[model samples]
Target: MANNPNENEQAQIIHWADMTADRIIKQKGDKGQYVLASGITPSGVVHFGNFRETITVDFVARALRARGKKVRFIFSWDDYDTFRKIPANMPKQEELKKYLFQPIVDTPDPFERDESYAAHHEKNYEAQLEKVGIEVEAIYQAKKYRKGDYKEQIKLALTKRQAIVDILNKYRAEPLEDSWMPLNIYCSKCNRDKTDHIKWDGQWEISYTCELCGHQGSENLQTTSRAKLPWRVDWPMRWVFEGVDFEPGGKDHSSDGGSYTTAQEIVKEVFGGTPPVYLQYDFVSIKGRGGKMSSSKGDLVTVNDVLNIYEPEMVRWIFASYKSNVDFAISFDLDVIKTYEDFDRQERLAYGLEEGNDKKVAMAKRVIELSQIGPMPTVCPFQPSFRHLCNVLQINDGDIKKTRVFYAKDIKNERDERRFQERSRCALHWLKNEAPDEFKFTLNRTRPALDLTKAQTDFLNNLHAFLEKEWDNLKSDKELHEKLYEVIHSVPEFEPMMGFTTLYQILISREKGPKLASFILAIGKERVLGLLRP
Candidate 1:
């Protein structure tokens, strides 16, 4: 269980500004300034799985800045990477394949006829990061670094191209056998760089064909090489070109002898600079029947899906709740409901509306710490239950503001309010799947239908009468339970315990529920009698 030193500090961990300053001091050792960099490819809608890396890098950046160190945090979008394939559930399928080799920034939006698909994906993710409080100077790879902005480095790579090939050979890895192209070959057909055959003729001649498109090209091995560098070289090359100090990547690249290791060596050898410190983050698995959310699989749960159910802050809390290496699970279940409730309870305590227990205080601190961001908009007033608000307004024919305020006051805490809001939004879901018209309220536990004997029917009638007459007198749970028990005891034909079981079965279909007395009180004696009458 390795812990992050920044988070596990014994004393009050200083602010993010202070942390950044401290890291800068240590990394530079009295040097001038340092820059932090992170990047992601806009291949698909940015899912929580993809966010693991982005959030980890953002946290590191924040930590560095907190320490009074000058830091430049840059987030690069690898939009120039070719579109891979049309994901499932995307509105258009075969139509999008035409742009497979083009940069993602040049692709058309699947949903819209006019907008480029790359812009569509980029716009959504930019908004998501804003919601999550991640601020970074964005660089689009297609625009910023394209047209050979890294021409010098590319030239260096070409000069030491043989050296890189020698290193690959040392590792027993064979270079692509084609002769007309440079060592690195990016297929114009697939838009992906994984191609075959890089054959070298004499000192300055090589060629390769796109394994995907079969398009072939030749270039001088000297300065006229048109092939892109392999990822193993490209990644470290960027670290040197951009002066990246720290960047976090997925565990795949962070493995014991993965590309990052090779890239680090190439960065030192080719670019004469050390690669950035790397933090490896784990995957996020979605709960229920769906497979693990994946951008490549096109079965991803995007940040928008979470925002639909949770506030921006709660979403941030999820990112901060666990360390980078530990995989975590998110469910649309009772557990999620409980988490929202707990967050609300803690929030109430923090705001001084309730008695704060130590646990509540700690939870409150966690929520606030994770959600720290710029000032929240005044326009986005907390709406506890979107469905409830919609329903109350729909039924009463009133403004949403009135309903929001009413529900807000009743919520007791922020987390509970959020839970109720989510549940409310799911009202239509439960109604469609679980609820029955015969009973307006769905029973948590279903009871099988039972035949009522003559004696049972008569006893039920008497019980109903007793409840109808005593309904108003039953002011509390204790009073209701006592009256019901007394009536059962006085009935010679009815055993009190059996009668109680019969009553519970007719109502809840279970032998147990909330405190029986409290349950009856909450539903009211009249409703209970109506439910029990034969």
Candidate 2:
């Protein structure tokens, strides 16, 4: 295989993120502190598509801190926004219907929790992020708005309304009407913000007639926190308020004439602030790269779902190794096992357990470095292939000790033992739920279900004797595998594959399975002898 950053190289290499951070620091002119910000609207159950933004900023923040820069990582949840549609996972859909088009903070929780609807989703979102070891200063947009933190920005946007509209119109095929206003206000009486008759009093208040409830009233700009700027304006407005040095947006927002384009223009023209350094990350899909996954469409996966089967580091590796610009999938089927195998091989090559080319090794090492959720491991732990784990787990009936002995032969240290135990738990859950039929196996407890031919019978008898004589000599799965290959190929009456198939049928009552020698070793010599003898 290819190796990265060969051991002999002396030149320093700058990672992509490091280069970007350096530029950002220079652009900001050595501000005493930099803020790395990423936010998502908690409209419903936030899915992995949402996580792309969260993890992208997280990786960049870590990269910046590694260079001795001070960074405050902030995660904002736009929970104050209205509840437009019901999420599939949330309960009380009928009860929640009444809150449609109302600010999420004003709506009651669907589950009868004391918290509002937005708070409920925020709690769930933070819990999943915790599992992945991402720590950030979580801010709720609803709370910030209600506290009147954006009052000054709201006034400025109203004053510069025409400039903001002109910038927005440049990209829109349909320009806004002359009467267009950049703000929405929650009606004082009805709580719904549906109003087209809004007129700014040119000072600290705005008059409006609620279209939904028909209550006419004026809200004080300095006192009432119900006024909110439109999304395009709000996005850039926050960029200035938070002093964000870097942030990431989804491809949908980053496209030409999209929210980002308008926001960029608004930030420069109306807000009089420079937009932050931005990275446009692509979407995640279930059908692999380029396939789109959407929360609103009910096509989604959560971080908890991914972490249920994958080790946290492996989960981080998927996002860390793949550049943010490329689309990827979080597969849950048999292919996931292959993904784990690839991660393990890359890890070995990165940590120098296996030798390879230099440049490839360096790049691989960087990936492992960034993918770490906590402190990086000092020594590479024993990595067992997910497929091998599944098979051995079946043979041992999910006994961690026997499986560890079978795979590791002996514990290398405390770290290796802990890793083995953790991996076993993840593998068992995957086998029970996600593993495909071909990967599933059940050892037969009754007599062998086979009509053995004379040649097959002869092959089995000879193999049993061969294994018994070499049992004490075989100290590892590798040695037993070589012996099994020699004996099976030596018999002309039985083809090599057919000989292995006969053993599987006798031992597992199946025509196919894991390597016969290794499976026998995991099941123990006495068990195999008793099953094969007589």
Candidate 3:
């Protein structure tokens, strides 16, 4: 993981974010201000698969600011992109088919809540980003285009049409014709891009015949509201438009002959602008679903879905913990519990409450610094075992308020109480929703008829007798745990597993559960002895 760093190694092993920021400043030169950009086409619901780009830029932006560099982080919603297909998850699938080939911004909202399909998806995601502490100057391509905001850029692209073709065809198996223009003109009449037989009249005027509605007209490229550059041209064109210093792309765009390859050439040769310092980020897959997520498929997790299980800080931690180029999975499976545990460990290291080698401490501090949303605490944040919360919440019958009351004595401060509240809510949600059956339990209403061996029966009987008589003497969970172990070894052939399983089955109707001694104490000595008595 190359996570830790020694004093000498700190300079050598910069965090991926700080390293990337350094590279950007070196490549672009130290300017008064720098622009970092990201974007996605709102063709459907924006899933966490797309959030990778947004968070990558945010990390770099923070790193740049840490070095006292002025940073402008902008995210674009390419809502003006064509609606090529109806996603399977959307409603009115059959009706939406008729809207294909139009701008996504112009399509009907399948959910019928927002102004258009693009706004519906875009607005929801913008709010989600704010929840996780990412702030960006959001540029909506549809609104910009409809307002003719990019007409000047469009005119520049039209002037370099042939040069753009030359760069693109360098990688294309077949050549693009000289007559090919660098723009798509949506038919102003039908408002659909289902048009062909185009002709560029050389200067700020292009004529096209609508294949769908049989309309023909010349659009003044100098003033038209429907002109759009192809992805390759638009990508570089915008780099110049916004003076972008850094941007990250997916593996699809970073390949040898991918959009980025040609875009770099087009930016330099055609647009006379340098390409941004670019990094290629790997894909995010769902655990147990070993494939890339697609918005069109809708079989993917969103940022909200993750937030439902993890606190806002933990959400940022998961993404910041990974290098941008490393592929990772978002787990809604058992790994969720471990993820929480790992973050809590990082918190301990960051606060110096837990000891680590210098390198480990440095890495943990950096990750915690990046992962935090508000001010860093002077002390260690309260550490809660996510697995314990699951057990405790279930033992409380999933009443979060009641569960909070149980942990109130342990919470010493306002911050710790908030931590407990957030974590318990997330834990209960997971236990009820995504947690696998093996991790879940319920107090048995009546004991299951168990065919217990004599040794198992004797172990339970002895433990029951001790708890019934000396329960008040047990001062702490750890002390009770040792006492339980002492009792288990007293009976001959009463293996530790045999005794533990016997008690678990009699109480929770499961062979496995939370740590037996701690869980028994949590269930209360009286309640547990009621089940264990012979």
State TM-scores per candidate: 0.69, 0.93, 0.94
lDDT of 1 by residue, 61-171 (tens): 655554455668788887766677777767777888777756677788888943677777777888888877888788877664446566667667767776665555554
Segments of candidate 2 deviating more than 4 angstroms? 1-13, 287-291, 405-410, 489-492
For candidate 3, list the clashing residue pairs, or say none: 5-359
lDDT of each: 0.62, 0.81, 0.86
* Candidate 2 residue-wise lDDT, 1-534, digit = tens: 233544345234445566567777877777767899998887877787898888888888887787787889999888777778887777888988888888988888887764888877788889988878788899888888888999999999999998998888889899998878888888877777687688898788888888898888888889887889889999999999998889889888998989999888899888889989988888776533225667766545778777778888888888987878888777777778788888998899888987877666776788888777677788887787777788889887877777777767645877677667877888998888877777778876654747888778777777789878888788888888888777776677568888888888888877798877677876777878877785
Ranked candidates (TM-score, high to low): 3, 2, 1
Task: Go through the candidates in order and give the C-alpha RMSD of each one to the true structure.
Answer: 7.0, 2.9, 2.5
Candidate 3 local lDDT, 48-130, one digit each (tens): 99999999999899999999999999999999999998888888988899889999998988888998999999999999999
* lDDT score, candidate 3, position 124: 93
Number of clashes found in candidate 1:
34
Error of 2 at 91 (Å): 2.0
Q: After superposition, how far is residue 12 of candidate 3 from its true place, in Å?
A: 4.4
Q: Rank by lDDT, highest first.
A: 3, 2, 1
